[model samples]
Target: MKEIRFENVCKSYGKTEVVKNLNLTIKEGERLILLGPSGCGKSTTLRMIAGLEDITSGSLYMGDKRVNELPSGKRNVGMVFQNYALYPHMNVIQNITYGLKVQKFPKDEINLRTDAALGMLQLKGYENRLPKDLSGGQRQRVALARAVVKQSDYFLLDEPLSNLDAQLRVSARKELVKIHELYKQTFVYVTHDQVEAMTVGDRIALMYQGHLQMVDTPENVYNRPANIFTAKFIGSPPMNVIDMAFDNSNDSAYLAGQEIPLQEEWRNYIRQTGVKELAFGIRPEHITLSKTQLKNGLKGFVKYVENHGSSYGVYIDLEGNEIIAMSESNKWPPKEAIYVEPRLDKMHVFDKQTTNSIGYPTSIR
Candidate 1:
């Protein structure tokens, strides 16, 4: 296993810069996920690490050795793409051992590697089957098996599970996690899927507009987002952000026309920071909804309801701003107006102008 570090790394094509001043250190044997929307330069950053794209400036290191000029083959990194990328003409065994054979590995060593990969990825029974004969999931496993047999120091995956069905993708994610645990190789995965990033990554590197937004553990990225973008991007239904005003003289905050209750610590922070206008945010799961009005709760009319398996998302419109709250009961479109109350400890406060988090000085929990 080798640690990968980027020091002021930048990538561009002519005049357009896709990656800008990236400085990140990926620990050895850690699964780091590059997560963001399209055109955010995640795949481009991965390509640069794999030596598929040249770094426009700065340096990239693989455990102390600078690899800015290294070829992809010499980098000893295994890669799997979204499109399977398996040879349709070759059988499973042949496909898995192709790289080893090209590297002129000994017959016994090749057999040993292939057999281990096949067993690890549960593809032993389909060794003789061609790519055309296998299912989509099986084909994906074969692609993974091929990469595993290489036994490279770094494993780079670019949306490898994107093509699989929902159920298959879940299983594949588990298998990938298990493979990483067993192999202990440095993994750099790229995807726009938030679920995948939250599930499979040890640390998530969120990027936007060629800039690194935040790099932290999945839990941290979700619970203690650095800014409004991080908070909004990481959640499922996304966080509900509402513009609010704070009165320093009374040490009170109000949303729309209703007063918002804040914990003592939060009130103190806001008073010390002297912030007047703020963007208050809370996750849907953290907000509780009630048919009857609750004390110190914001009331809104039910706009719609979205069923999510066991839970229902109740969308409520308070004034002109919309907020969603998760409900366990099957209350589809409440006849009466609903009341929404965000947990005082769970509320996030961001600067209205800068859109940066100022809720808690440190991460909550």
Candidate 2:
């Protein structure tokens, strides 16, 4: 299987640019998810690889050869589109065998590959049903079968599970992974849904506003975000950010004019950096709420509570800033006074001016 590389790739239509200076490499035999919100240029990037979109500048490589002008049919890539893209008029077996037949494969060879794909995608008994007659999940499987029969070097899926219901999506994701293990093809998956990105990808390539933001394993992207946008985008409740000021004389940080109890190491790092204005971030799960005022705690009032099945999200108002803390249950009513405490090790600090992470300031003693 071949890997795909993008070197300073940019895509534009007339004057409006979509993908800007993208530099990323999808490693061989690994699943890489192109993840971001709508209009982030994720689908455009995928299309570029599929040769469906032109790269206005820079180079795209498949393995060692530049494939910037390769035709879609000659790229040795099997793609599943967001709509499943199955032929409405063709039955399951016909759709799966069409490509092989078009390529002039032997009749026996076509039947063998088509039958294998049908069994693999659990469409054994539905071979005679047309795409219009199949349900969303079944049509999706037919699309998968079509791609699978090709057995190309690169397998690309653009939000293939987006149209399925929740339960079907879960099973489809598993099937995709299983298929990857069997084929060992380089997989490029595109999705705006973070859950699919987290669960399916070997590494996630996050994009924003046509720029590639960060690329890393799902765990690093969640816990060690590169910037404010990444930190805020990965979580369900998101990370809470508060503007803070540092007092040089006292070697302390203040939030809403209340002195924060900064640990000695953090204070040392802060002093070393000399960034007077900082943005402090803590995830909802790392914040604790106390009814009684604890020493060095930040005072706040309960603004609201939301139940997320397993836990309660307690939103608190600290002066004008609103933040959330996850609790096992919702005991505090709205307007109740509360104190918020954050785990020091789990805290995130960012440069206020650039909105980039300072990287959990710490060093060997």
Best by lDDT: 2
* Alpha carbon lDDT at 289, candidate 1: 81
Model 2 agreement with the true structure over 312-349: per-residue lDDT tens digits = 99999999999999999879899999998888778888
Candidate 1 lDDT by residue in tens digits, 1-365: 39999999999999999999999999999999999999999999999989999999999999889999999999989999989899989999999999999999999999998888888889878999999999999999999999988889999999999999999999999999998998999999999999999999999999999999999999999998889999999998899999978888787889878998777678888888876678998899998887788887888888888898988888889988988888898675654588888987888889978888875855344
TM-scores vs. true structure, each candidate: 0.96, 0.97
lDDT value for candidate 1? 0.91
User: How much RMSD separates candidate 2 from the native structure?
Assistant: 1.6
- Candidate 2: residue pairs that collide: none
Note the Cα lDDT for every prediction shown.
Answer: 0.91, 0.91
